[model samples]
Target chain A: MARKSKHSRPDEAFEPYEEHAGVPMPVNWVAIALTIWGTAMLYDTGESVQESLQDRAEDSDVVAQSVPDEGTLLFGANCATCHQPDGRGLRDAVPPLAGSEIVAAGPDIVSRILLRGIDGPLTVVGQDFDGHMPSFDSALNDAEIAELASYVTTRWADTTEATAQTSEEVASLRAEIGDRGSFGGGAELAMMISSLPDQPPMPARSHVQAGDQAARDLVFAGRDQVWSCASCHGDLGQGDESTPRLAGLPGAYIVKQLQNFREGTRENESMQLVVQGLSDPEMTALGAYYTDLRVPSTARPVLSGDLKRGEQLALQGDWSIGVPACFTCHGPSGFGVAPNFPGLSAQHAPYLAAQLANWVGGQRHNDALGLMAQISEALSTQDRRAVADYLASLPPVPAGGASMARMETQDDQ
Target chain B: MNRYLPLSILALAILAFATLMLVIAPGMQINSRPAPEGLTPYSEAEQRGRETYVSLGCLYCHSQQPRSGDQAPDGERGWGRASVAADYTYDQPHQLGTMRTGPDLLNVGARLPSEGWHLTHLYQPRAIFDWSIMPAYPYLFDEKPQAGPGDVVVALPAEYAPQDGVVVATQQALDLTAYLQSLDRTYEVPADGLRDHGYGTPDGPEPTPSEEER
Candidate 1:
């Protein structure tokens, strides 16, 4: 080894050797740290991307699942409001789906009920559900008909053991009906199918009479002095322009609304003032009376424009502007599907127009109806008149009628 | 001495840069607060009206955002734009709500022509809209005594008078009118009406429609 020069210090002596070294120690540490941080950031970003993709994939899957089983969505959207999400049915007025003999009966009986709505007194699951469940035969396709029937058969009542129905079966039965005529009562359906068990006998007409009288007396009498129900609702409860026709409404729905009016939950200053003095018994009586009255088509207004315009608007909303047609939920005749949507046919045109305007103006509040209001506001005054007139002019499809069977089946699905 | 100068200069520059970043960067944010180009500050009465709206839970059913799609019935109903974040720079707690029991209220004040009509409709919906299902807000107005012949009816207040010089106003009605008039949403930038393009965000250069041999 050569001796170091006297001018070079010990640290300076190493400098010549250090020149050959590749990277400094501190730079190496920094490089490693940066690499680690970059790796972590990339990992997090990848995870988030994966999560987002998974969510989108799941949503698409749900849509795909819904398309094939469209009946499930239809049933949920339409019937779940009244029959409940589980298909167990509602209390008092609606029959149970749990172990009903009716549901377990032959498919023809069920199809008949779907084709024609049950009118007069009826019982379900040992409980009375008197309201009409309208038919749906014309609205849904044959495939939809099969799907709904299958769903109802497999899901509700004690139908786990019963054989499921096919689209061909529903289509065959539809053909026999010949242009979708109405089914009068359970007896008629029973007569058509010998194997089907008879429906419970009709309740005594006297019971209806007594209920009507009690309701009439309560509605007619007022504290001090005021207008009677007849003054606003008209003689047979065929409502005029100022008020809605109350006849043919489901009793349970009427009772709930009347109670709401009296309690101020569903507030209208005029209605509140009108109902303010009535007792609960009186409201009940009023509901019973209204329910007993027969609905008359004569009361419905004759529309001016082409029914086609109304039909187009009702069935297929002006999609160019993203408007949903009214019939999607409110049925073809404007008779609402359930307790959630009130009947529109036979309703006063002025009342309909005002309600539409009010909904647009924010003078009313209903989550679903709010959507309708938004859509309604887009309409010109003339369009509103035309639509309302068309709805008013539509014939009331009779309860338990064949025309409504498809509608009922689709609803159940 | 000269050899050490470069190192010292570099160290000083780095320290100075860090200090400037720490001290000055926060101040930049103050001026950076977004201001939607066309909006103006609300008037004092309008401010009060906004407060009244918040207190009344009006946001529960109504939304401020209008959909971006071409003239949905909702837009035709005069509920203004599907709100952008820029539209709510002034809002402390944004009122772009979700429930829709009633129509959107972003441009309600400008949409409805008459304040008196709103008042009457609010007071007695059934009288005006027979199928109205909304709860009445009678507390908003003082009940006018049932008019009797020869009971010299006082004219409505000067503020309540119609803009066309036709009608008079009540105090409650005036306050409510102040509130409704405050709902002007004219500051919104109109969407370019392009079918697929989203709002606010700039898209590619506009395509000019061709004239057919004009």
Candidate 2:
């Protein structure tokens, strides 16, 4: 071994030659120490980064191991708010997905309804709902809608009859609808949806039971202090643009509001003045009479707002700002929930906007459990106007007077 | 000279990490917290008023945050509950201040529900309280010979009233007052909204004396 070069590896002891031979020994030691220090610093400070990287690795590992939970995730994001996670719709407002004849009918019916949405009265499982079901034509893609449809059908439909929806079916349905609006009503839907079972008629609940004749008389003829109900609320109690229509409202809701007005729990100068002279009997009679009256929607979109944006707010809320969809609580088409959430459909746009403003400004404090106040506060002015206009554009609940009366007569037996 | 490259890299890495730890990490944590229930967004008028509040630097004299019971007697001071992170969800560039020159206004709306009182106080602090150290914001109002339609007349005391005209609140004053009125956080705070200071539990202190007296 004649004069081994400094750069060469040692063969005798299996030791490697120093790479940084030109640098000082202390500097070399310092560099080694620094390398350890910097690595320790990175390890200490990069905990979050390390966690995220590991999480990504784990995610990939899981992806390789099993099918993705895309259906469950999509259903949670899209349908869970209204249809509920368990697939039971809210208290007869939204139709239950579980055991639904429509869902069981197969992919065509569900896909069509999901694509175009429904704008008129719908009867599900003997319960009547009049509201707008927003069209997913623009919001969701064919594959996503298919995933949602399949998820709901399988999750809620009878296990033996559960059918899965494919993207091809959704795509075909989308092509056929060709940008048509929501199915107008049950009749129009019946025309489109084949194999859909005949829906049972909704059970009649008496909204206007016979009451004090004296109070009924007071409704038509005003006393010396109070104006007649027809003067502001219309002859048929069909509300105008500002004053709320009393007709078709739930009797209990009307009575509660009247009591709130009387007790000053709810704030309204005109309502306060009107309720001062009315006795309890008169309020009940008026509520009952209004509940009996049925009228067509007279609401027109008067306020200038982005109808598309408004429709989105009414159907799909912006959860980023904590605003929920109007139909979630107001009934499917803003037809109003029975007791607390009043009908927003066909109410004047300006009036709706004003009420929202009142809620935001702390002027109106009678909202159920402060939910409306908090929701109103979250809505921007433009959003408020948009939702109000969209609600105004929705059709009113179909008149069920004749059938309901017949049902009520039967119930009397 | 030869060590410059590695030395610079090490220095840069340290600096970058310091920035991430001190600034980015805290910012992400704050931004991720969901807004507490009952903490609503400001209305248009309230938002405008909040801008006014910021422009006026109301934070200089009045603090919106109250210290915890262990830190001070803020609860006994009738300033309501100790301040929490979720309370400021809608507040951009939070108004938490260190000064106690004036009372904390976190629950001012609940304390002062009268808009007229606020208008009068804004026009001249002495109008309501002769000894109040708060500076008057007279510029927020205008003296008009007669109240115009939609112009809110400030109900000033006879001495504070303009000699020959009525004091009317300008839109800015109304907006600022609306903002102040929207400061009511008296709604029951959710359990998650409380800060665990390593203590057992953070129950909201007794109802403020002012609320009880009212």
Candidate 3:
């Protein structure tokens, strides 16, 4: 045989391919790869198929079709500006993200760093780094942040493998901290995050169904032909950037605000005109109409602020600046407490911004004890923007959304 | 030796690998997260308004969710904190749009709380924002010969409003407005920890220390 003699074991043919002496079947790799590329291309794409393929080739890894990890992308887009793409932050200029103790500490500090920004001095990976790391409260949403946190915690926090931080965990941690330092979201404006009890807001028992037939009738049809709440507050008493909504408001609360407008306690030219000759019954009916109508969510912000900052201002007040938490008086969730504070949750940002500016400018002095003015004056324009945007972004607790009723019930308290 | 057996086994293995990497692996990462606390579903009016918003193709110009400040200056833009998944628990169809032709309206309700302003703006974007690129929604309103007792008159500039009549909001306008107004989400989710996030940074204007110290 040709495969003979000189070979030590001539009798042993090339095992499986005995007939061919080990020459294996060649695969048409180029053809197989083209088929995959064609198959993927055949699936729908955005621009023209050709254009999409071209763009995809440039932006994506042809070998791996999945979108890049959110954290890696976020880190590249955000942290890389200073930290360097390799995550070995510029020595002395910025701290490294990879193998950093802060990242190793998990998502809390990492998230906090992202939300509030690091000012003064921060020690990462045992080296003291000091510089202004801008706050991201207004920029990234909680989920995006969570993804970034997970990515960093797992990918860069350490050289060893680690589990990613869940959006829930990042969210909860964000709730507990970020933007709490100054006039912010719902917690103590003056309290530091570390001092917080780590307790979630006390759960309300039940949401009061503020629906009233009289109110609905008054809202849809003009009360005594003088006014229809729907006229100003679009169909369900959903107000815009200029007006306060009456829908889903506590009946008594709406009545009080109306009374405030009428008595010049709340100085509003349009509202004053609307409430000019409204009688008690008409007001009550109107209040009922809006109260019964569900408050729609409206959080379009004309001027952007730090959502994290806004959240901080709304939850915790910058007691350092004498601003109280919005929730202290407005309810733990900014859902209006009966008879006093109106629901700031789901309110319009421009409206809130206007009111805050009015308070700052001393143009509108209707809140009792000049509370609104005092707080407004204390807030810087930036603070106003933050709180307004934050308050505007909140989802109002529905009338029957909760499991139990709050301590202060309408008319009961 | 059935040649089909190895091929079938290979296909099964490929399917298993795909499921493991694409489905199981990623699912294991995000599925553990619980819905954020204090997140409520959209109300009937809000839902109707959301439908209106979708029908109007508002998503074409505006994005509901905000990206990180690192990605964009949206934080300084006051679009609200980066939106989380919990923010869309009730969002049957998630609106994670990325168009910024206009400003982010994720919290527009809180930003501008006026029905009249919104109505007027809808009727003519130029009325409130002179430089607004948004087209007018004249179809959303009815040109009534006279302003009825309870009819809302859109305070449109003479250029937009009919010279002989007032603009009355139609049902579609109302539905859309309701949805627009209900977009506030300022409440701190349980994940944000204890304090809210609305104050100026320590680097900004120095906050005067208050009397009551915690």
Candidate 4:
């Protein structure tokens, strides 16, 4: 293209335009071979093909007996990052789908991933995956996403029970979830999951297993520099009307609170002082000690709010006002999720309301991704009070898996 | 044979040779490489999102190809290492636009991983970049008087955040953002790929590294 030799120099040797004037060098065969080899390398690996033709062809011979599973293809394309192709995830880095808690937590938990995407640390099989999964809300249609969710849940079942979820079910849930930014990460997803029905029931006994001996000793008798938790909290780990009852709370939640107190994440002069001289083990032990103790009484309403309204808020949140039911994150039956989310089953109303208000005011926000902060800010004081009082009124609830009661929800707000 | 017939035949042969080199060779050169290690095919979502990218005519402003440092200052500008043909293996009608009125998006996903940041920037670019000439795509978002529960509140600057309501990203905007997020080409180029391998074929070992290293 550079030198139109005939056109440029009509006078000079017009007969033979056999050779290119651009370069005197011949084509580099080494370069061409390496290029082909490199290309073959990429093709063999199958990381970046359009249809993955070769992979499909190879699989067709053996693995293609079943109807072309759209979900498998979709998962290989999308969900394989955190959830592997085989669904055996990479340790704490990504969660495995082989009997993943969220995948089988029911359609609402996992289907929401396609629509809103999930972020923050998620606990699957009790291990945390800190990565964020992007939303496919606009990416995939209802039917495609449905098939994908179905594939993962059923194909990866603990016993291959083959729970086939229909596309209609996915369509309905999609319409229900509507458009929201990523379910605001896992805490919110946990809350949403908790609200769904047919959840695993609470344990028979409260499961108040004992704590570390060293920590139990410290709870009763403060070590050299520290004071005991029993000063304000009752000897039995039960709190008075003003103080929060710590008994039977999840160990993770208890430890987080003590850590929060020490770090000023959840500011409290008393707790800060109590935790000041406590070392990591002492703090962990204190958390364990409280968790293991069984309280004689559940939380009661020290101050009054509308019990009926509180119950309504606790059980069925005012979605019109952008408030999710309290138990969504807390737990089914108002008992809290362990470690991070405290059970609200027997929490005192005034204390709960105060904490909710703190979330609104940005005074207390140690919750993952500051989820409580957003939820509380959207709530009015009365809504917070209604939910808190309702929580306090419930009888003691036993700890159970996170799957919440299945309830139909509004599309957006 | 007539002298004019021989001359005409020579002219025709020359013309045919030019066509082979000029018309067909570049096309072959464009696609002669394998996809790089980190490069992945577009997910269904990203594929759907790409439609938004195309429809919005982002190509008019943004380019997806970055030339090597020797050719341009793109490397110094942090556009990433020079793009290779394999980088576009998954791209259909690759968006190697000529005009670069906006930054090259060859490695945007690596540059900005946050969807929120992208959504906000799409809504009103100047909100974040005070001197930006890119027009705002307010239509790609919904303005709500008060954000509903589960609504994605665009993290706009105070000036861009609506005085009365909140702004939530529209599906198109989200799709486009996903496509943008999928525009990563920051994969560690294979040893041969990092060389002067333009079409997965290198003329010589890369000049920067030692000759023995190759």
Alpha-carbon TM-score of each model against the true structure: 0.36, 0.37, 0.38, 0.33
lDDT tens digits by residue: candidate 2, A49-98: 88898997787677656754888866655566557779877653466778
Best by lDDT: 2
Q: Judged by lDDT relative to the true structure, which candidate is superior, 1 or 2?
A: 2
Predictions' DockQ, in order:
0.02, 0.02, 0.05, 0.02
Q: Pick by TM-score: which candidate is best?
A: 3
Listed per model in order, the count of residue pairs whose N, CA or C atoms clash below 3 Å is 26, 3, 115, 14
Poorest 10 consecutive residues of model 2 chain A by lDDT? A400-409
Cα distance off (Å), candidate 1, residue A136? 15
lDDT of 3 at A204: 32
lDDT of 1: 0.56
**Superposed model 3: Cα runs more than 4 Å off:** A1-214, A223-227, A400-413, B1-214
Local error of candidate 3 at residue A390 (angstroms):
1.1
- TM-score of model 3 relative to the true fold? 0.38
Give the fraction of reference interface contacts each candidate recovers: 0.00, 0.00, 0.06, 0.00
* Model 3, span A42-87: residue lDDT tens: 6745347778778766665543446566577677655564467787
Residues A53-116 of candidate 4: C-alpha lDDT, one tens digit per residue: 6666666656545545677767754566335568887664455778766676655456777676
